[model samples]
Target: MSSDEIALSPSSLAETLRAGERVRVLDVRNRDESDQWPLGGGDVETTHLPYMKFVQAQAKDEIGDLAAEFDDGERVVVICGRGESSATVAEALREHGLDAVNLEDGMRGWARAYHAEELDADADGATVIQYQRPASGCLAYLVVSGDEAAVIDPLRTFADRYVEDARDRAAELRYALDTHVHADHVSGVREVADRSDAVRVVPEGATDRGLAFDAELVGDSDELTVGDATLEAMHVPGHTTEMTAYRVGKVLIDGDLLFSESVARPDLERGDDGAEEMARQLHRTLHERVLALPDETVVAPGHYGDDADPEEDGTYTATLGELRDRLDALSMEEDAFVDYALSAMPPRPNNFEEIIETNLGRGSVDDDEAFELELGPNNCAATAD
Candidate 1:
């Protein structure tokens, strides 16, 4: 909270970066913790270091090597869930005779302070794709084709930028909607679609209550070619009956059905029903369908929220070849995966109902209204299992 003081608060760290100061973000949380809840991207350069591991142990032995990675006198801002762990790391770095500043309030405070940015607009060429890293743990995308682009879960006002990006890319923005629905920040799919002349496209089997659209009612293996890429619709129902995965080339746009590597939480919609359903579906999909693809295919998933393991973010982009070799669901018998999934799930966010309604054009709020409600990055959701 202090400015002149050498130590920095997360809010102040944000302010300093805004002022064009160079700061290095050092995360000291454990590998698993970082995976579930990471610090979202913003105005600073961040380097991750799991607490008391090879990276940390080596920091002392190679202070010069570590210091060489940074500019002379660059303020090193270390962080973790609470300030204590980061503070300790900073002290060690400082004692090693390097200029470093511990980030006060740490990761939690950072999530509370800085806002996420929309990096690429018109991301998927003429289709107009926009990317958002919201609530530290969640990643949402909006893509448009012609006068119609689909919005998967949206995180911030970044939705507006997504629309603008579509315009810049010379596409007529039409439809906005999520893959199934969401449990994190209220989905702004409809909020954004309404901002333009777009309709909302709910997956064919999802709940429908008279929403207007160029209804793209699809079934298993049905594919839609938007812009230059083809998004194949795979009806892999486990996380939810309506849950679908959109595949383009080797890249699978796996909504909550698949994460960087792990399948998404199934407990939200089904509760106890979810655990059994997810396990069964996961076994079939992973062993028979997904893993059946070429090992080199790339995988991009939906819902990387507060529950993801941060240490795995870089490696999150796993190849079909790699995923097949490493997937736990594949090795486990169906019953085991069901039990494991139930035990691993975090509580779904308290705002899922609101998010679903909002995405379905039933909620009462604008994009700005929803963005303000989700300023802090918290993307953890516990489903029905």
Candidate 2:
């Protein structure tokens, strides 16, 4: 078969999953790797079988018999750490008359797969584009107005996507902004600035954490203009000491401060020894800063949990009023809120320490290394009970 006929792009698989089509996935990675970060989507069935098993079966001339276990008349999408091993297995399955295709570039490609949707909210004559990374539930935004654009919390893997997206809209990428020093993934702010004429902006609080990059440092209530639109910085430190949210008209580009179903884990910035105090700070920020916004203000968070459901428009956003009513942590007293924020947190994101260092400009990594470092679910939020 031709290469195109035997290969599936990650974007194509994402589309199929989003459309609720039934898909059978054959995961050829080891048990630990498969269990730690399983593929996720709607109406999908996944079977985990290490590639070594296929190797052993092929050696005994039982490849056909082995393929029989997965030849249930449906196309199987095979995946591995990278696409190399899976391609061999997929070709073997095809030789046995089963419809099998390799997931191009494997799980790493899936992690790089991104989707952009125009948000259904008022951006004061500006367009708000929500970039969703389904693999990690990381969310970023692009605000465009009058030939000028700014990106908030972009991932390094897709820095070019943001610039290309801005150019396609007839807008110049004016600003690359980071809400905080991220711990889950490498920040694309520096890369975006290097690729375009955009100015790099980071929170002033980040300087305390040894921010080694050259950029404009914004403080509380600072405003930046993107053509006719205004991005007003609101320093709402909690998840991290530098956590900031940008308000573009009625849409709030809130960082890890809040999410659709859960709140940010405060311990990422400060270890457990200082987590309680950070949690207390988080509670105050929620009530005095976030909840203070108008009920109609659309809250666009930095990350979404697996349980988060997108709105009818396919954007992971909610109004301040809706989140206020839904999140129990948002309504609790200070003491209770702090306790809730710290209890039952999921494991910190994989390679988070190194990721944070790289994001802070204290360390450097090549593009491939950066992509590999963040190839897992972004556990940036506290587990909701």
Candidate No. with top lDDT: 2
**Candidate 2 on 17-38: residue-level lDDT in tens?**
7666888999999999998888
lDDT of each: 0.57, 0.91
Q: Which prediction has the highest TM-score against the true structure?
A: 2
RMSD of 2: 1.9
1-385: candidate 1 lDDT, tens digit per residue: 2322446866665455434455567777777666555554435466777777625566558755655665467677777776877776677677666667776766545644523333221134433232424334455554555554555555444557657766776765555645665655666555566677756555776654333334455667876656565567777766666767766555566666666446666666666655677657766776677777677666656645422332232322456666556666557777777676667565455456665566555666765566545534343322322
Candidate 2 off by > 4 Å: 60-68
Q: After TM-score superposition, what is the CA distance of residue 1 in candidate 1 from its true location, in Å? A: 13
